[model samples]
Target: MRKQPPTYSPQMTRMAFAASFAFAITAPAHAQSTVTLYGIIDEGVNYTSNVQTSAGHGHNLYSISSGILSGSRWGLRGVEDLGGGMKAVFVLENGFDVTNGKLGQGSLEFGRQAYVGLSTPFGAVMMGRQYDPVVDYVHPLMPSALFSGSIGAHPADLDNLNNANRINNSVKYRSANYGGFSGEGLYSFGGTPGSVGTNQIWSVGFGYSSGPLNLGAGYLVARNPNVSFFGTAVGATAASNNFGSSPVINGYASAQSQRIFGAGATYAIGRATLGAIYSNTQFRHLSGAISPLNPAGVEGTATFNSIEADFQYQFTPALSLGVAYNYTAGNNANDAKYHQGSIGADYAVSKRTDFYLIGVLQHASGIDSTGHAARAALNGLTPSASNQQAAVRIAIRHKF
Candidate 1:
């Protein structure tokens, strides 16, 4: 060495540099971390045969709408490998009105979902604002997800199958799939000083899927429906947020607590799939101040029972048709009944683009939450002035 190290050949030096560069690039790939950006946009024109006008009169209306087949949303999701069959994961999703370019979900950014947690071989545990167990494990089996989107949801989305609300300050756990079965649980804090349970929410759900059959069941309970489910502040007399404002359940907005239980199943046969769902919703400790539907300013309770059946057929790899029927009955505060029918068709333009048309019909009978004759109302639309309502929509959707 003292005699001067033999000069390294230029070729040897170049080879050494290439080897180090390759190692640097290959090492990161082995960790298996990834981040993805994704989104869906749905825009449409809607026609309603009966819609409440500014003067509280029913009138035909035409307007632009967003989120027919699916809510327009954009999100970022990421996972970082932590070794030993574990990973760190996070998701942030935002909902918006495509027509007006305004934020949805109470105008909060990332209002649809925001969570971070660890995923392991055994399960996943996340904490933040997120969908409850019912929405995660059970809602997907409902017609609302399979047929016509929000228009096909249960009356008032009483069972939350439409995911009208997202829990805040929450902790959730999802079990790893065991063969064809999985389970989920969630708890949301009230975040109220001195009252840990005043506005809390809790839910549990289980699901099973094997081949062409799928089944799901879930239960959810929310204390202080106005404050907890609607994201209103404590002591708010009326609902501050518009979540779950459908005429079918609006009168019960002041309920002290709310509970929902639901179950659903779907089976595939050839090119068609058949599904059925049932849900029971209860509103407790209602007062006249909260809803005029209560018995003459007196305290009372309310309940709704709903059932739905649906079918979907794939005419071809790029085209599909669907039909659904729903029945809902309300008791306690007011005796009301609702019947709804929905039909839809979709054609795929590409893997990421599609066109769709949907129609819905509804009829209502008996007393309503306003203490007046019940009015027909389709989900996501204004209540009809009378007992019957009809709606139709044509739309284009794109995903990326």
Candidate 2:
């Protein structure tokens, strides 16, 4: 080696050292670090028996829609094994429309999820934007997660039980399961200067699974629900008019706070599974919310109660059927009521590809937050101009 060194050029010696250094650095990292890209694409043709327009006109609608069964998204997951029963992990998920290549989730990049965390034998801690406990733990037991997808969600998805919305500036903790029992919680910062609790959100969830039975419960509290529960406002109008989408809770935007509590259970028997769920949503101390129902705007309280029942059967290894019914009623404020029903069939062509057909029907009664006659509204679709609305979708989904 010494004789070879004497003959070697400085450039060669430098190259050798650089190669060895790079190898040493990359070898261990290559073995411990990994990154994966995954995504789901769902699209279909839909027929809505009635679709309401801004003019309040109801008309038959035929359109191509995305996410009838599952939301279209692409995500990257990364993991680094830190050794000694520890690891580092992160995820960046983006929601988009396959038809027009437009960003989903209010057009924000990586809006579906963007978080980083550390994992240990005990549990995992994640920070950034993510789903709340209700959407995580209890939602899976809902009919929407099993079959009909968004359309199967309760009227307006008022309780956010079907992942209709997400939390921002959040820190979440997940505990490892112990004998089929586990739990999770999250706290979100307001991020407003000098106002500690102005836009904060907090959620907790507990779950249990044993054999063929599953149970879960969750609770969520939000300050400034006008911005936290509803989407962002359009400019200064946000101060007084922060409501957007469904007429279900639009009039209660001025509520001082928001609270939602829900619990659900599922029992599986061979090829069939039966599920039930209950939820209560409240807007406390509503103030200055201008709407047709509350023209003068009052400081009253509003609440919504929902109950759901569902059944699913795996007819075959690649084919499944599901049906669900949900009843939702509002207390006093708007006195709105809705009955929704859905049935769906799914067939798998391969492990990552599937086709599905789903039909949904909704009937509304009482009064709506818009101060007009109650209208039927389904999740991921526009409201109807009348009391009853129906829709059917044939969709294909692919995962990678």
Pairing residues by index, what is the TM-score of model 1?
A: 0.90
**TM-score, one value per model:** 0.90, 0.90
Off by over 4 Å in 1: 1-30, 232-245, 290-298
Q: For model 2, how does the per-residue alpha-carbon lDDT over 7-84 read when each residue is reduced to its tens digit?
A: 778999999999999998788677698789999999999999779887878999999988767889999999999989
- Least well predicted 10-residue stretch by lDDT in candidate 1: 290-299
lDDT of each: 0.85, 0.86
| Model 2 whole-model lDDT (C-alpha atoms) | 0.86
Local error of candidate 2 at residue 208 (angstroms): 0.6
Relative to the unseen true structure, what is the C-alpha lDDT of residue 256 in candidate 2, on a scale of 0 to 100?
76
Q: Candidate 1's error at 14, in angstroms?
A: 22
Give candidate 2 misplaced runs (Cα > 4 Å). 1-31, 232-237, 240-242, 289-298
| Residue 124 local lDDT, model 1 | 99
Q: How many clashes in each candidate?
A: 0, 0
Could you tell me the lDDT of residue 272 within candidate 2?
Answer: 96
**Model 2 compared with the native: what TM-score?**
0.90
